[model samples]
Target: MDHAPQLIQERSAPPATLVIFGASGDLTRRKLLPAVDNLARHGRLPDQFALVGVARTPMSDEQFAESALGGKSLLDKRQLAGGVRYVAGGYDDPETYKRLAETLDELDAVRGTSGNRLFYLSTPAGAFEPVINGLAGAGLNQATETSFARLVIEKPYGRDLATARELDGVVHGAFEEHQVFRIDHYLGKDTVQNVLALRFANSIFQPIWDRSWIDHVQITVAETLGVGTRGGFYEGAGAMRDIVQNHVLQVLALALMEPPVSFEGENLRNEKVKLLQAIRLPTDRDVSEAAVRGQYTRGGTREELMAGYREEVGVDPLSRTETYAAMRLNVDNWRWAGVPFYVRTGKRLPARLTEVALQFQRPPHLPIPADQLTELDADALILRIQPNEGISLRFGAKVPGHSFRVRTASMNFSYDQTFVEESPEAYERLLLDALIGDASLFIRSDEVQQSWRIVDPIIEHWERDRSPIPSYEAASWGPTDADRLIGRNGRKWRNAS
Candidate 1:
């Protein structure tokens, strides 16, 4: 059995001010603000830390605080409200940017938080350029000896490869590569990072991690709910661009990358970039054979009816958008040669779960009779990423009662059982990492471009092919074609349920 990971004490972040561009947006209320509050509760926030909210909506600091951190005692509300301020103006206006700079300067004096600034672009993708340009105009993107300036941009970085490169150029103009942080909350999950710890820190798994011992890998990110009101946004970004392009690909890199010489930001990311570069870019013929796309149809009883993709609000009746995607990929390098890495993601599936499973090659010889081992399954190592974060090792074992009958059994290690304190939310760990200038968990510019390079061909192929998107019931795992995509190779998706 693998030993549990050692617990580390939390450290406080440096004194700085966090400026949010879309403070009135849903992300702020649902994720950002709550994460900050949780950090404060854990005493991970610096004493001089402060927040400055900038948005087009006109509102006082008091009102903004109430809207963001409401339903608290007066004293508790006032404590967090003390360090917050709000600025209102158009995102493209130079005057608004000037006011933001002045506000941060004032907070530096009043709150004793140096000129250190961490600007968060929580606005829509369209607003990213204008906001970055405005910050540059105000000279807020530069760093000094005593203070540092970091910019955190949210994802769906661009529509495709061309757009992603253009956006990178514009962002590089305002801030140097070292000062920019491209956040991917998936990396913040305890289980996701635990993958690295499992391979590098342990002695048993590392030896058999290469192609000689492993057969194949599967990564699945499924959702239990549909795009209720974000249908308009979902139309532009199908599963390939939204999930596979960024989150799913990043997970793949972590699972397959070579161990770095050191765990420093640059050293770790360098190995990941190399792994991504090694993935074979699917050819036109491979695209048709290796890719599967789908949309969901209505299902369930009338009283509990589910809406189809076309029936969702703000979506076109004849939309060709895909809510589900599955693709088979291969890394052409020595370590992973001939091993297929299958990845799939979708909405309105049977359950909400994210996981990576490594299926090992079956034993070359079995001394027992085939009939006695009828219940045996291929040995697998599953790393569950959410809901119940744990590591499960599945292997065949002899049945207790009798004559050498073999059955599959699992040895599980759960985070809740191993550690006393709750794991930090993905956003919380990501936020603190940004504040402290540790870019190890954040994506690099080159890493982003390489991922886009791998995804662009598939998007183009799907467009030109104009393949009819298959449909499955709202709560099914996915379309049958996805099953067939893997089934053709004499394999199947792990029954995640």
Candidate 2:
């Protein structure tokens, strides 16, 4: 007798049609389709399912599907076998969406989806309004007893607070707040979820989690590759909006949030919102003191490989775009009042990594001699989110030698070392959540707006000042000032740590 859960066997109530508005775009080919396919391959997707892709290109459904999914032979063979429906035309044209709604209907005719649909806004930021309007104008949002229409939007949700709020208004015109899913892919990481497990599930860490015991928290997301093809997008977005406003801040929230009452979507999101709200928005002086923005010039480890930001294709010759950003923020609450949470992210750095390092201060006074205790350092609890996935705790213990001295040691738990089979990729996990109707990892609209609110003033400060924002080597962590941004305060960047 099979004992697997019924939900694992039965198709979810969600109408299983994934309608991609910009199916031909880079994200669809590189990320969305693959993520959806991974869900299907792992049996996380419902059996009655269809993917309807919308685009401006001149291609038949077969061509669209083939171009996007067919070229994915380089990926796991099983995942590439998933099928999808593709519909192409200008989203600006209402007739295109009329045709897309018809395609959803046709798929429903056979699959018994009963008008249920998940609309993915994979198009450009400019197209968000038109596409959203087109869907409603085409009656795609019409409610029925059995049919559910949900919207899943890609990020760069907006460039600033006003724009993000305006975009939310536009999306809300077609779908209610409950129907909207604003995904921040960083939240999908296995290690990001593990952060909660490490803190809440285990009793060992929480006791030392408060300001009295913890010194500081460092959340960093670094990338080794420069903006290549997305220079057009990166030039305007910059590192702050690209990483911090959404990804890095979300990571920070995961690291700093109070234990959720439960793991349900709304319950978890409530804690995240609270953590974000607790963060004191930077004052002008705070901006001047706590923030540093930088760009990359023509220096890298390989002399022949140097390429400045301006020299990159699709970038302005005098672009003030910042590829690197670092900031020190204080959450204005009793738990983290005195502790500064340092955040940083950048492109074309030494390597690609995302980590949260919680540094614990040294003992108030070591009874042992300075020479004897010199080997002991501040304890750091590190959760590496990528490149390698693991948790390490640095603590002091008695040295093996007869002499009475303390030495730092690392207690390590690596995902690879423990798991026999593959860990589900972040995309795969996130796609499954969408299928199961979970938003624990997805940002709420208010969260998105608040993030933009916290970030917009920094954008304003840069626009008005227009200083050179300093440039660093392509392969370096960031500009020299970034080092002093942390070091002057007796702290150091984790790359150095």
Cα lDDT, all candidates = 0.91, 0.82
TM for every model, in the order presented, reads: 0.96, 0.93
lDDT of 2: 0.82
Compose the digit string of candidate 2's lDDT tens values, residues 170-193: 988888888888887878878888
List ranges where model 1 is wrong by over 4 Å.
1-9, 72-75, 78-81
Error of 2 at 128 (Å): 0.6
Clashes of 2: 0
lDDT of 1 by residue, 321-402 (tens): 8899999999989899999999999998988999999999999998889999889999999999976889999999989994
Best by lDDT: 1
